[model samples]
Target: MEDEHKELYIKEKFNNIDYMMLKSITDCIYEAVCVIDEYGIVIVWNKSAEKLYNIAYEKIIGQNIEDFFDDAMVNNVRKTGVSIENKCHCPLKNHPVLANSMPLYIRNVFRGAVSTDRDFEELSRLYSELENANSKLIFLENQVKKNLGIFGNIIGKSSSIVKKIDMARQIAPTNSSVMITGESGTGKEVFAKGIHELSGRKGLFVPVNCSAIPSELFESEFFGYCSGAFTGANRKGKIGIFELANEGTVFLDEIGDMPLSMQAKLLRVLQEREIIRVGGEKSIKLNLRVISATNKSLQEMVKTNKFREDLYYRLNVVEINLPPLRDRKEDIPLFIDHFIKEFSEKNSKNIIKIHGEVMNILNQYKWPGNIRELMNVIEHIVVTNKNGIIQKNSIPEYILLHMKENEFFKEYPLDLTRAIRELEIENIKKALKITKNNKSKAAKLLNIPRGTLYHKIDEYKIKKL
Candidate 1:
C-alpha cells in the first residue's frame, strides 16, 4: 500500500512539472537537445537540434531516435536505466559531436532519456589555431634567425664586404673544404655561418677554437669517445663537433694554432671521411663540411715547419682572405653605425649621436683588433652615458692617447698656399674616413653639398680611402 501511494505521489509531481516549459527553455539555448519516451520515440526536439541536424523540429519530434540517429542512447537508457554521459557521437557522416544522455525517472522507474550535444567543428578549429600560434612563438624565440638580413647578419655595403659575400654565396653550394684567413676579430665565424645558412644543410653549425682545446684532449674533443673511454669520461659517451654537425658545417676556428699531431689526425678524418672514437673499436662515417679559419698564415707556418704542408694544402682547397679592418677602413664607419645602435638599445641608453670630433678621431684610428674591438667600445660608450650625444670627453683614454701620438699634421709644406691646400686635404680625408668613403655621407659631414665635394675632389685630386 505504501509503495502504491509513493508511486501515485511521484506521478502527480511529474505531471505538475510542465515538460512543455522545459522544452521551451531548451529550444532558446544554443546547445542541441533531444528527449524521448521510454519506448524510444522522440518527444522534445529543440531549435538547436534542428540547426545541428539540419532537420525541422516538428518533423523529428514524433520520429523514433533510432530511425533518425542510427540507434541513439535513448533505447539503451530505457533498458539499463544507466546514464551515457559526455560520449562522442556522430549522427551524420563527417559531423562529429559530443553528447550527454541520461535516464529520466518517475516514481523510481525509467520513464525517458534526454541528451545535450556540442558541435566538434568549432572545437577543432580553435585547436588548429592554437597550434599555429605556438609555432610562431617558437620561431620568434629563436631570435628570428639572429635578425639576419640578405647577407646573414654580415653588416656592410662596402665593395670589399660585398665581394666577400658574393664569393661566399658562390661557394656555399659546393662540398669542397674552405679555409677563411682573417685577423682574430674580422668576423670569420660570421661568414662561416652565412655559408652554412646558404648551403641548406639540415643540421646545426658547430664551432670550436682549435687553439683553446688542450693538446691532451684534442682527439677526444674532435673525434668523441666511447662510454668509459678514459678515467674521467661521460658515462653515456659524447659526440664530437664533427658528429654533432653531421650533414652541416664544422667551423674549426684558429686552426693554424692546432698542434702538429692534432693536424695529422684531423687530416686523416678529412681524407677518409670517417672518425674512430677515442677508445671505440668501430669507426663512424661523417658527412660534414669543414670550414677552417685563422689569423696566421698557414703557408708561412708550413714553410717554417710549424704546420704540416699536406694539411695546409688540404684545408686551403678554396681559400677566402678576409681583409683586415685597417685595409678595409671604408667599412669601419658602417660597422660603427650598426654597433652603436645595437649596443645603445641593448644597454637601454638614449645616446643619439657622437660628437663631430669623436667621429673624426674614430675615422683616423687604425683598428688593429677589428670589428670585435669596435663592438666592445660601442657597448662601453652606450653604458657609460645616460642620454644625449656622445662627446669627445667620453672617448676611452687609451684611444685618445693613440690618436694624439699618430697625428699626421706636421708633415705638410710651410708656404701659405701649400699649407692651406694641406689643411684642406686633411679635412677632406677626415670627412671621407668618417663617411666610409660614401660620397653623400662625406659631403653631409663636411657641411657641404655633394656637388661641391665632388668638384673639390676633382680640383684637389683627393684620394678617398
Candidate 2:
C-alpha cells in the first residue's frame, strides 16, 4: 500500500511538470499575453506583456486590469464580453499596435477578459516612407509644369510663344543638335540659354561667335593649340573652346559665317565624337550638345558655297525658327512696356507717357533693326525728354528722316490748311518706325485706341514699309 501511494504521488508530480512545460511553451510563443479573473483582476502575464506594459507580473498579479488600460477600452471589454480585434495608433506612445481580447467564461457565464498586442513600429515606419515618397512625386510634377510653361525663364503669354516654349522643353532633354534660326535682335540667345537650363546638365554654357573670331585664329581657338604650335602660341598648351565646352552645351552663334576649314573640323567632331587640338596628334573625346544660331539663311549659304552643306545637315537635326518681330507684331506693345519700365528704373526717370502723335509716327515706319533698335530708341527718348512725357519733337532725327521720306505721308500737304493732317501723318510714320511697324504697340506708345490707329493706317494708305 505504501509503494502504491508513493507511485501515485510520483505520477501526479510528473503530470504537473508536463502541464507547466506546456504553459511555458505557450507563454514564449505569445506576443503580449495577459489574463484577468472574474473581478477583472490581473491573473496571468507573460514576458512579452511585461515588456510591453513595463510592469512585472510579480507586482501586478492581483491588480485591477483597468489600471493599465484607458477607461474606454475597459468599458468596451466589459460591455461587449465578446472577442474583439482591432488596430489602434497612439501618438503619445509613438506606436501603432494590433490589439485582441476575448472574454473569459466559467460554465457559459462571462467572467473577465484575456488580451494580447503586437508592436506597430514597423507599420509606422512604412507609412512614413510612403508619405515621403509622395511628397517627392508632387515636387517633381510641379517642376515639370514649370519647365513646360513660362516659369522656366520663358515669359511670353502669347499662344505662339507658349507653343514654342513647350516644344523647347520637350526637346531640351534629348542629345540631338538643335539649330535655332531667327532674325537678329529676336532673343535667340535667350532661347538657347533656356534650353541649357532645362537640359539637366551640370556643365557651363560656352558661347562662340563665328563672325567675331578672326579667321587666322580659328583653328587655335576652336581646338586649342599646344605649346610652340605657332609663333604667338602660349608657352603652356591651352584648352580649346571645344574642350572647355565638354560635358556641356556649345552655342555657335552666326554659324553661317564659319570658315570652310572650321566647318570641316566641326563636322569631324560631330561624326567622330572627338576633337584634336592644333599642333597635337592625340584626340580628346567629346560628350556635348551643339546648339547653333544664325540670322542668315544656312540653306542659301550652303547653295552659294558660303556654308558647308554637310555641316549644315549635321547641325540641323532639330530646328527651332524664332518668328521675327514683324511677323509677331502683336508682341510689340508688351516688349515696349517691358523695356520702358526697365530703362525708366535704370535712368531714375518718370517718363511714363508717350504722346499719340509720336506713337503714330513710330508705327508707320519700317524697323530694319527689329527689337534691338526699338529698345535703343526708347532709352534715347527717356534720357533726352523731360516733363515725364515723350512728344513728337523729342523723337530722334533719324526716325523723323525715315518717316518724312515715307510715301504714305507725301499726299498730305505740309501747308497751314492741312497742318494738322500733315502733322498727324508725319507723327504716325515716325511712331511706326520707332515701334517697328507694330500698329497696336505704336498706338499704345502714342496713347491712341487701336481702332483709331487702324483708321489712320488705312486712310493714309500707309505703304507697308
Candidate 3:
C-alpha cells in the first residue's frame, strides 16, 4: 500500500503540470529546437522548428533526417562529429536556409544528430545593401579629393601657361603670400583659384575686391566688429572676410587700389599673423594664405607715396606675371577650337569647320581684351554661323572695321572705308543665305539681337545670296 501511494503522488504532480503551457513556451522561442534518435531519425520537433522549415512537426518526427537533405551533408556531419553550419537551398520548398547540425553523444556512444535552420535570404539582401553603400562612399571620397586639387578646371597645353601652372603647383603646398600681376583680362584670378584648390586648407576662398569696397566699411569688413560697434551694426556680431578666410586663401583683387590706412592694417596682419576687431580690443590669431592680384604698377604707386612700400615688399615674395594674349597669339587657334566645341555642344549646333580665310582674319586681329574677349567672340560666331562652317563674312563688323582702321592695313594699300562697306555687305548676304530667306533665322545667325540685324539689313539694302 505504501509503494502504490508513493507512485500515485508522483503521477498526480505530473498530471497537474500543463502540457499546453510547455508547448506554448517552446513555440514562442526564436530558435528552432529538435531532437533525433540513434538512427538519424527525427524524434521531437517543436512548433518553432515546424514553422521555420514549413514542414509539420507530426510529419517530420519519426522521419529520417536525410529525407530533407542530401546524403553528402549527413556523411560530412557524421565524419567530423562537429557542428556544421552551412547555407542550403531547398528547391522543393522554394526557399533558402542557414542550417546548423550537431551530433548527439550518449556515454561515449554515437547517437544520431539534431539540426536547426534559419532564413538566409533576408541576411543576404542586407549584406548586398551594405556593400552598395560602401561603394558609394568610396566614390564620394575620390570626387572630394579631385575637387580639392590644383588641376580642377585649368585645362591647357600652352608651354608658357603650363610652366606658370607648374610653378604655382610647387608653391601651393606652402603657406606663403602670392602676388599675381598681369594685364586687365589675363586670368590672374584663375591662378589664385588654383592655389586655393591645391592648398590642403579646410576653409573656402574669400575674394574681396579692394577697389569695389567702400572706404567707410574697410575696417569692419576686414576685421570683424562686435554688436553695436557702429550705427548699423547687426544684433549679433559679424565675422570679417579675413576671419572667414582663416585656414584658407583670401584673394585681394585690385589690391593696388587699397586705401593707405587699410594698407597699414593689412601689413600688420601679415607681419603679426593676428587681427583685432574694428571695435574690440582682443587680438585673434589667423592662419591664411594671401593671394593678391592687380593690373596696376605697384612699384609706381610706391614711388608716388600712394601705396605703402612696406606692404608692397611683403606681398611681392612670390610673384607670377601672366603673359598678354597678343604675346601668345599661337594659342588663339587652340582657344578658338576649344570654345567652338564647347558652345556648339551647349547649343546643339553642328558647326564643324572654319574657312581658312576666316581663321587668318581671326589670327591677324590684335586681341586687346585678351582671352575674355576672345571667348566672347567665339561664342558669337558659333551661335551665328549656321552654315556648319565659319566663313570670313560671319566675322563681326566691329572687328572688320577695327582691322580696316589699323595703320598696318594702310601700309598694305587696303582702302579702309571701302573695305569696311564691302565686308558689311558681304556679312549681310551670308546671314540671309544661312537663314534660308527667313528674316528671323538670318537675324539670329548675325548675332545682332534680331532687331539690330534687321535694321542693318534694311540699311545696307542686302538681298539673298
Candidate 4:
C-alpha cells in the first residue's frame, strides 16, 4: 500500500504544472533551496540558491551540480540516500551555511535530494565586528592607563573648562574670596578643591556645607564655641571649620543657603580676619582662603533683599561661574571615559569600551544632573555589565526613552541589502501616502519601473490603502 501511494505521489509531482508550482514556492522561501537528481543533475534552483552559489538556474539546471559545488550536500544525499539535518558547512568559499538535505525516494528507489541552506554571512560579520571592537577596546584601555594619571580629577578639554582652569590657577595664590556658581551636580565642590590645591596653602582644606548646618549652630560651627557656651558644648572647647582650616582654605558649600543672621557674622569674620570664641573673651586670629559655592543667583537674592548685599560683594570678589554640562557638551566624552574607568575599577569589572550606540545616546542626552548624574549612570552600567564591552541593552531604561525615536536605528547595519530594503519600504510607504495609493504615480515619483514597483509591493508585503 505504501509503495503504491509513493508511486502515485511521484506521478503527481512530475506533472509540469505541479513542478512549476513547487519551483515558485521554493523561490518564495527565505532559505536557499535546491534539488538534484540521482545522476547529480541540477533539477531545480530557487533565487536564494542562485544567490548563495552565485549561479543562475538558467545555466545550472540540466547541468551536473557537482561541477559547480564541491562536496555538495544535495549530491551526497542523492548518492548515499542519507539525510543531513542542521549541519554547518561552507558550500561556497568563506560563506558558512547551515544546511538540511533529505533524499527523495520513489517506489523503493533513490531519485533525488532536496536541500535548504541558510547563509551565516550576517553571523560571521557580527563575529568580525566583535573582534574589531575588542582591538579598539584594548587601545582605549592602554590610553586610559597612560592618560588617566596626567589629567587629574577635572577631565574636560572644552574652551570653557580651559578658561576656568586658567582663571582658577591665576587666582589661586591670591587671598581673594572666590564664589563658584553653577547648577547642582556641576562639580562646584570639585572646582573649589582644585582651587584650594593650587593656592599653596599648608593647612587642611576644610569643606563645610552651610545648608546642612542648623541656624542656631552657625556661629559655633564657623567659630569654636567655649567649653560652657551651650549645654551640648564639649568641656575641652572644640575648634570650628575656620580654626581647623587656618593657614589653608575653607570651602563653604551652598553658601547661598546661609541665614541672614549668620551672614552678618560671616561678613564681620571675613573683614576682621579674626574670630572670637563664643562665651570666651580671647580673639583667634585666622589665616585662610575662603572659597564659597552655590547654585543660586546671589545677585538676584541681593535685589530681592534675601541675601545681604555686603556679604554678596565680599564673596563675589572673584566669582567663577562653572558652565552646565549641556553648555559644554564637547567635554562629555572625556567625562564618560574618566567615569567609566573609575567605576569599572571600583566595581572590579574589566570594561574596555562602550558601544558606539551607547556613546551616541550619552552624548545626545541633556545630562540634567550634570557630571554627578553621569558618574552615577556609568557606575550603574559598569556594575550591571558582565562583559568587557558595554552593549546597548545595558543602558538604563529612562535614558533610552529620553532619546529621539529615530536615533536608535542610526547604528550601521550588518546586512546592507536588508538596510536598503527597509529604506525602500519606508520611501514606498511615504510615496504611496503622497500619491494617495496611485501605483502609477508612486512608481513615477520613485523613478522605478511600474512592473518592478508592483513586484516589490507584493514582495515586501506592503498593504494597499
lDDT of all the models against the reference?
A: 0.78, 0.73, 0.75, 0.81
Residue lDDT tens for model 3, 1-465: 244553354244335556346556667767666655555555556787777667796566556666875542443465568777774735235666666777877666776565666667665556535643453455447646654322236655678878888989999988888999999877787789888888888866777789998888888888877657888886455678787777778999999999998898889999999998766777889999999999999999999999999999899889999887777777788888888888798778899789887887888888888877887898899888877999978888888889876622332227888777777676677667767778788767776677887777778877556
In candidate 2, which residue ranges exceed 4 Å CA deviation?
Answer: 1-155, 407-465
Model 1 misplaced stretches (Cα beyond 4 Å): 1-152, 408-465
Candidate 4 per-residue lDDT over residues 1-465, each given as its tens digit: 244553354345465357667778989998888887677777678999888878887777767788888988888888888899988888677878989999987677777898999887654446535643453456447646654233357768899988998999999889899999999988887888888888889876777889999988888877877668889887656567787777988899999899898899999999999998787777889999899999999989999988999999888899899999988889998888887888777778999777887888888888899987888888899899887888888888888876644343344467999888888887798889889999999999999999999999999999986
Please give, for residues 146-175, the per-residue lDDT of candidate 1 as tens digits: 553312388777787789989999999998
Task: Report clashes for each candidate as comma-separated counts.
Answer: 0, 16, 0, 0
Model 1 clash number: 0
Top of the candidates by lDDT:
4
The candidate with the higher TM-score, 1 or 2, is 1
RMSD in Å for all candidates: 18.0, 21.7, 21.3, 40.0
**C-alpha lDDT of candidate 4 relative to the true structure:** 0.81
* Candidate 2's TM-score: 0.53
TM-score of each: 0.57, 0.53, 0.54, 0.56
- Ranked by lDDT from best down, the candidates are 4, 1, 3, 2
Identify the runs in model 4 with alpha carbons over 4 angstroms from their true place: 1-151, 404-465
